[model samples]
Target: MAVMTSRFADGLAVGTNLVDTAEAAIRQALAGLSGPPDLVCFFICGDDPDDVGRAGQRAMAMVPGAHVIGCSATGVIGAGQGVELQPAVSAWAASLGDTKITTFALETLRADDRFVVVGLPERGSDDQVAILLADPYSFPTDAFIEHSSEALGSLPIIGGLANGLQGRGSVRLFADGEVHEEGAIGVVLGGPVSIGTVVSQGCRPIGPSMVVTRAEDNLLLELAGQPALARLEDIVSALDEDDRELVASGLQIGVAMDEYAERHERGDFLIRGVLGIDPEREAVAIGDVLEVGRTVRFQVRDAETADEDLYELLDAHVERTGRVDGALLFSCNGRGSAMFGSADHDALAVRDTLGPIGVAGFFAAGEVGPVGGHNHVHGFTASILVFSSQAAPAAGA
Candidate 1:
């Protein structure tokens, strides 16, 4: 297990057997606290879906009064490493002296013409931090995020999808010690605590910026008055052998969040995948929305880019906050050994930058975090939430 202690709380993680992992993590976390923790958040993995509830019960039995939230995951993250697609468990507990911690659950339902989300409670009064675990099957995460962006008003919502069943039967989520098979379970934390977040999209800009001269929703008809495919061909001809190969493997579109900036860099772009292309009209269908006049650029991602982006974000976070008490990492399931070609790439990045801090989380089907001031559902991304005890408000550099 790994533990990071601040003024009031401690963060902890452990991985072993199903129930044993939770019990051990809870004991280690509570050992450093002055009293009962105000909140206990956990993510675990087990071959059997029935083990989820038992693991949660084991953890809660150790910490009687703390509000508990947890979910089942494909793999568990903690102890300065990630257990990719393995049986493991990780828990983050906060003592929270006087911080107000409230746990809640929400679900989305089809409302004929639109979807209506139920069980969404009011936001916390102060600048609260939201941690969420959603069911990939039942929840409309994209629509919910767009709605909550307006409702929560910059309140950061960061978490991952439950991968217990990998979108088959009901996956389990935890709220107040109960295991749920549907909906999203979350906890809103406020008062005294400050949180710094870094959602590493793990991509770097490739080509020069261009304006979308014409488009239809997510379909890009033209770029700088040229057919999208023709523009891409031209750009491809200009690249060296390696870059051309990268384009063939993973070419993405980047939409500039702030077009008025004099210069744009890697983080300035909200990167989206190029789903496919229509040669008949030479249009490109991207994973996100597009408009007629928005500025965009091409981007690429591989192991090198992902490493640089994640570490750069982490080192920058440490430079700003100085010290992090605890961290929750929600990494895309596509990451881990698949992208980085090794286990524990994302979790170890945080440990190398922060030096053995408290860290725990899981591999998610889809990750949720802010990209240029708005929360969006992302894939092949690692979104980190770092907790701080500083008097200053939380900021991501």
Candidate 2:
């Protein structure tokens, strides 16, 4: 008798040999599944491009009929642990009953002063989610995400930028069964399976939200009839000593995505860095462009704040949508031991709160996920894609 069921599993292995590590990880994941998976994704963390490519090829060969995709990272997360600065491989496999998977590779073309993304496939009506892995040095991820609505409609994207110690020319992306030196690779999944998204920017707002009275491009000229920098200074002066210390080290600006919302909270704003202040103009520069009438607030981040932010979101996910069948986590490379002073902080949180289920991912250069119904590339964030279990008719009933 034939059966139809959705299943997921993840595994991890660490060693000097990339191929051996990848094979062990894939085998560990495969052992947890009932049958062959429909899709397989692996993350390899190593410095050598040649070795990474070989390991990717071997992973593809191990799962011949399944769609394979992955990229090289500086660290990997799986098996309820995160391994950093080591040669490690993390593999995730899913047998999604009756789901359709389409994979494509995208490249960038320089036309005059602008770069255009080429090879974006037409999106289908049933397409629900897209998993994207791109090279930060070669791909214009920010621009692509900004225009994603025009190209792919409302489909949510969840993935991250591949990272390495040897920046720029060292990125390697894997799709189908091939390794790409430059460009981006992704897979679109459509079917009965349910996918949920979670994006935690790991920042907490510290001041009252104010509307922008004047602005020029990315420069904030005025806020609520006062100089932007001056307003910021006032806010900092009122904060307690700890918060003031946080602001002194580094500060961020959170731009409200929805202007009409009565209240602005943690997840409601898109956070940007407070780049530099122009004392002469009394203006503040941000990482993104801001328009007049937009609401903005000051934000601060630290180890304790980041931990609280992620765990709160994860708990909310469980309460609202039951337990997830599996999850793919894309955490900022700046996190892990650097932020928490301990290893496997994010990975353990996801597994302890929501898991014992399948979960795998890597520490990304930049995380990608939607905030307030819009996709954007973020830093110091943890972007996650959670899959719900699904069932369908037997294949040969």
Candidate 3:
């Protein structure tokens, strides 16, 4: 049987224009449905939190029975350059044929020993993949993933942390008609459905790999027996003026986790932001929690490097999937206009490389995708979930 899918988009001004625009968009999406939809994935963006909630409610009202899940974005993605500086909403509805959908939400996720995958009627022991969304501000995201891996027992988790404009104030997450804060939610797809994921790091390795001979929490004290900061300075000095300037603006470091092999490639490294440099101590602080005796490398980010890296990753995904019915993107909020100097760069790349498919997603605080067979929180990355229909089962089992 064919996997059925459809997509829709709506945009409006925030103050007085929200209701009208949202109503129109939701109606248009509902009208195009071939039949009743099983799931409705919505994306909303606005300057005000209240308007975002209103748009989410409008979407749920349009499709009462379908499972509604979405999060706020710094910018929303649609057919064109995403609706900017307005209360806008875009939604995609899917008629999941024989697929089982499971969803769960944990408010105090940090304290829980196990996470229950909700929405599915009964839990099965069979292998499953989870598409997760978390509020980065509340949960210790790293710990959550670690504990989830333990609880789920190697089940692959893919999705991103919901983000607001400029990474300050409150962010919004919607389920049904309600908006929540400081929580994580996800959908577990089991049965005949399968998910293909792609994580585009959008960066190229610049320097030689070094071993972390010494370190502390979130700080790299030494690399290859030399002070971490000293090594970073040496690498930056070797680069040309333009590249050096980019490094100085905001440098990043990648640490190879346990899953990666000795010979790591472009996407193998887990990228982390350089938090600060302690000139006196000669230590380098990173965004991630660190430990001693880890492998590390210095990396650079630029337009050319990012574009090349993204294209390469997407090209591989296209080759594997052959043809896709729909795509769900979890792109970093820092990447859109902040990195590309324009919007739709990441979405356009997916469309161009992966062929025309139903694409919908929101910009996230931290992008999520598997690297070296384990999921990690990433920045300046685009994580894609491609969906395709499965073959029908025998008539008489």
Which candidate wins on TM-score?
Answer: 2
Model 2 TM-score? 0.95
Better of 1 and 3 by lDDT: 1
Scored by lDDT, model 3 comes in at 0.68
- Give the clashing residue pairs of candidate 2, or none: none
lDDT of 1 by residue, 65-151 (tens): 889888888877776677766567777776667778878889777788987888866877785678888988888877888778777
Query: What TM-score do all the candidates reach, one by one?
Result: 0.94, 0.95, 0.86
Clashes of 2: 0
Model 3: residue 222 alpha-carbon error in angstroms: 2.0
Error of 1 at 365 (Å): 1.0
Error of 3 at 41 (Å): 0.8
Tens-digit lDDT string for candidate 2 (104-196): 999998899988889777888878889999999888898899899998977888899997657777788999888898889999988676778
Q: List the residue pairs that clash in candidate 3.
A: 103-118
lDDT of 3 by residue, 1-397 (tens): 0122353222222333555655655554555556677776777776667776676677778788877777777766654244544566665666666667776665752237864433322445653567777778865667667566656656667788876654555577777667776577667777776557777777666678888888888888899999988888888888889888888777888877553576756776888889899998999999887666677788778878888888887777656556566767777777877888777788788778866555667777787777767777788888877774433211100
- The CA lDDT at 38 in model 1 is 83
Best by lDDT: 2
Off by over 4 Å in 1: 4-17, 32-34, 110-112
Judge candidate 2 at residue 207 and give its lDDT: 80
Lowest-scoring 10 consecutive residues by lDDT in candidate 1?
6-15
Cα shift from native, residue 153, model 3 (Å): 2.2
